[model samples]
Target: MVEERADAGLYGPDSVTWRIHGNQSMALAGFRALSLQAVHPLVMAGFNDNTVWFDDMWGRLQRTGDWVATVTYGTTAEAEKAGRVLRRIHAALPPGVEPESGLPYRVDDPELLRWVHVTETESFLSTYRRCGGILRPGEGDQYVDEMRASAELVGLERHTVPASEADIEDYYAYVRPQLRVSQVARRNTLKFMLPPMPRWVRLGTPARPAWAGMVGLGLAMLPPWARRLYGLPGLPTTDLLATANGYAVRRVLSTVPLVITSNPAYGRALRRTRGPVAA
Candidate 1:
């Protein structure tokens, strides 16, 4: 992980986002980093043929080619406060690079792409621990089995059982270098773990996407022993701080009150003019 952030330019987008959001306060900065990390994947994962929540925000932009950004930073009020920083980050973009630009907003930009990668790893790990394997689809035990299977496929035995700090360091040394992540980038980004939303993060029981169903089927079909044998190599101890940090954010979000909003008065005016004929 230390080698992932060797270059100073690695944090360009993160710094820009933090600066735009006015995350001068470490607390806000820390929270913004985590929130953005979470948002990054939720958006991109949607576009793939395998994930459900394909970048709804980006997909809309693709259709209209208009800049209509939705700033949802945190699940709770405190996370919301940190989310303001992320809003500032999005709002501060220069011309020709607006969120509505025709290009794949999330993937086309290098800086934004980096953030997405970081968010995926951090968020998955964070959510995995927080849910106790229940939040994810399929049986709780299946998740570990799948991870072990994937690790084994990669030729790594570290995931066969709980890992030691030395094992984690070794894994990082071998894997981090291959990922080509600059040391500086890893240092800044990996120092903190983004927490999960404290409460059950429900989005009104929306329908699952077609692709997600397929991925779910694929996982379910794998034999239990086959999945368990697939190793996800890593020392449990090394992940302690990261795991704790994310839960801490979740804990903080849990304390804040839920926010409620309504349509503007102009909405009523528009509705009256349209006429409410058929329902």
Candidate 2:
């Protein structure tokens, strides 16, 4: 655990991922990117550090009483602007690599495009909403319309139509591979290396033996108050500090053992060395 934390701190900057979406008009792009870089130094200085830049922001938002900050949008205007920026960025991505099977994804591929739309929009909106933004009181429909429009702006469409099941399916298939890649990598990585994980790796809660199997039957047998009582123990509010601190500890531990190796680039440079010349 100690070594993991040390390695994490050592490599923090290269690994942090909280980059601001690029936009010429918004100074936020530069600031956000730098802030992402800054986290590593802070980690080295013994401050709490997040594994990722976005994770850092998410943690901050959650601490500020907006647990859903990642998925809710507060104002339509903000959402629109953000959506536009994302569209431009996506337009600029290089066409994706082809898989061994030869299927390929272009930046504008419907499935890939739509998933980006939904994800970024959802992330910004969730944070906004958690911080007290919502669909305009009487303009809920307008908000939905704007969201759909934004989705379309990014080249996302249903089977070449404005709306239809075929289009949706086409879009889903395109993005489904991306989702599978993300989910599988996440699950497999965790499970594969799980044995080495320390005991404090946030198992969350140990369910009582009775609740472990046949959920419907077990829950049905419990009185309503008992069920509620059981749930209360798992609520985030109760053990907030402990959970937060434990998470910090585990994150630090997970990256430890400073197995520093010379950079591959250094090796390349050495190959060009011709008998140590003048200092």
Candidate 3:
């Protein structure tokens, strides 16, 4: 029997979490996740309060990506440690009320976390399938099931999160009536589309066009209803073009060596877990 090492982390190398989160496409799909999450006024309000200036935009996201990387690829202990750090940070944030609804909010609230979690995994699955990553038959559902481990890490009750695409769609149905772009959400959308870049890159390189195009494609990959919610034209034609572009982007990214593309924590985990599993 090919037994996985005891220290293979929460989901191990064979997991859907690793496959999705480890991909370069996840970086591209991140805008979709953030865009969808911001439809909730409270979620958007929380993000609005934490807006990073200048290059800090990417810096903050990089820190988040590192946390995800550690959670996905670190040893079980390491993964739990990363989760504790996040919970502590979330706990420390002051609670606020949404101005319009007067609904008080906490970032660590389980319901809010569930919304974030579902939208995030939806974005990942959509990107994976549309960007040429294969999903055979029931594996999509399996992917959803496996991600409960992550939900548990982020202070969510695993049973409360969606465990399949159908469940995700149903949750969206319930939340759809409440979804709208508040002023905060609108600002969140704009910044996500135009993240800060160093002056030289902005002026000299094709950075603005390149980055905007990628963000646009990410937005296009969202469900038609979601794209419409953002006031973007969600024509099937747009999806056709975006899918082609995303496929090309994924292919190009795949050419870069794993060592170059994967985060250092992931690299170390692979080294620790590869080959010769002791029962």
Per TM-score, the best of the predicted structures is 3
lDDT of 1 by residue, 1-279 (tens): 132321221112222221221111222222332333322322323223222222353353232211101111111232334335444544454323212223343323434433333332233333434423223342223322333322322223524421332332343344332222223222322322211222433233322232233222222222232122222123444245444544554455446553312212223323433453334
Show where candidate 3 strays beyond 4 Å. 1-6, 50-55, 257-259, 275-279
Cα lDDT of model 2 by residue, 91-130, tens digit? 6755543332344455545644444444333333322222
- Model 1, position 233, has a per-residue lDDT of 25
What ordering of candidates by lDDT runs from best to worst?
3, 2, 1
In model 1, state the lDDT of residue 161. 25
Task: Put down candidate 3 lDDT per residue, 1-279, tens digits, no spaces.
Answer: 766654888888888777777777886778778778888888877766644533487778888788777778888898899889889989999988887788888888887898898998889898888888887798899889888888999998888999999999999999888777788777666776777777999999998998888877877887888889889888999888888888899898889998887668767777888855575
Candidate 3 accuracy as lDDT: 0.82
In terms of lDDT, the best-performing candidate is: 3
For residue 86, give model 1's deviation from the true position in Å.
Answer: 15
Estimate candidate 2's RMSD in Å: 20.1
The stretch of ten residues in a row with the least summed lDDT in candidate 1 is: 65-74
Clashes of 1: 24
TM-score of each: 0.26, 0.29, 0.91
